[model samples]
Target: MESRRGQGSLEYLFMIAAALVIVLIVIRVLSGVSSNTPNQQVILYADPENFPTFNTSDNYFVYQTTVTKIGDDLYNVTFKAIAKRDLSHVKIRATLMCNKKPVYVGDQYLTVTDEVENLPKGWYISRYWSPIRRDEFPCEVVLYVWVG
Candidate 1:
């Protein structure tokens, strides 16, 4: 009879150990799924061919503007430009408007590179990558130019 009691106790301990191992396996699998999943996924906003061009002035022209969603509140905006003449000093300003309301603004000084001059030629210009919120999508980007 004592041997039978010992056998039952050993069986109970074995069952408990097996249950613990199963619980650990489940926990590991769940952790791995969460780690592999991203909280925010990146997505393209608009097709390059469909992107709009904003030419506010004759001396400076704004080319295609492409927007990429990088996070829940982040975007990567790349736009092209062209100068009608050689500008010793130039300032390019970009404004993102949603529903006719301005949401974000950015600007950059044109660095004097051998590739860029005040000429009627296309040149890739500034990139604005920052958090601008997901609700502000489908925004219209307008670029203003100041050259001296």
Candidate 2:
């Protein structure tokens, strides 16, 4: 009877140890998933009220530039442009900067069908990968826009 009781207690100890190991494994997996998720923020140099209207003229106006993180190190950037005067063609150029360093640059050509009078035309940039560290979060993002 004494030997049986000792064996039963030993079994219970083994079961408890197994449960603790399973719990630890679960915690580690959850923490890994959370760490890989991207956290993002955008900073604008110009005033919000005057934004998307940084400059305007009888020819063209550039505005509404934004950068957003879509996934781990992935981003989606967009901006707006408006035509003030009739033109045969137009070109839009964008430069994305992080921590005062250029990370991406792109350009697009616009046709007459792409815009309307007094209406803003939208441009999008997708899947931009940024190589930055967690400590650099909420990093300053600057977008430079030009139309020609």
Please, what is the whole-model Cα lDDT of each candidate in the order they appear?
0.48, 0.38
Candidate 1 stretches with Cα past 4 Å from truth are 1-59, 72-74, 99-124
Per-residue alpha-carbon lDDT of model 2 for 1-148, expressed as tens digits? Answer: 3544345788999999999999999999998775443221223322222331233222344334444455665444344444444433333333343433323432221111132223334332222323332223333323332322
User: Residue-pair clashes per candidate, as listed?
Assistant: 2, 2
Most TM-score-accurate candidate: 1
Cα lDDT of model 1 by residue, 1-148, tens digit: 3544346788999999999999999999998776534332212232223442333334344355566666655565555555444554455555545532224433332112222334434544655444455554555555445444
Lowest-scoring 10 consecutive residues by lDDT in candidate 1?
107-116
Candidate with the greatest lDDT versus the true structure: 1
Each prediction's RMSD to truth: 19.7, 19.9
- State the local distance difference test value for candidate 2: 0.38
**Candidate 1: residue pairs that collide:** 85-118, 86-118
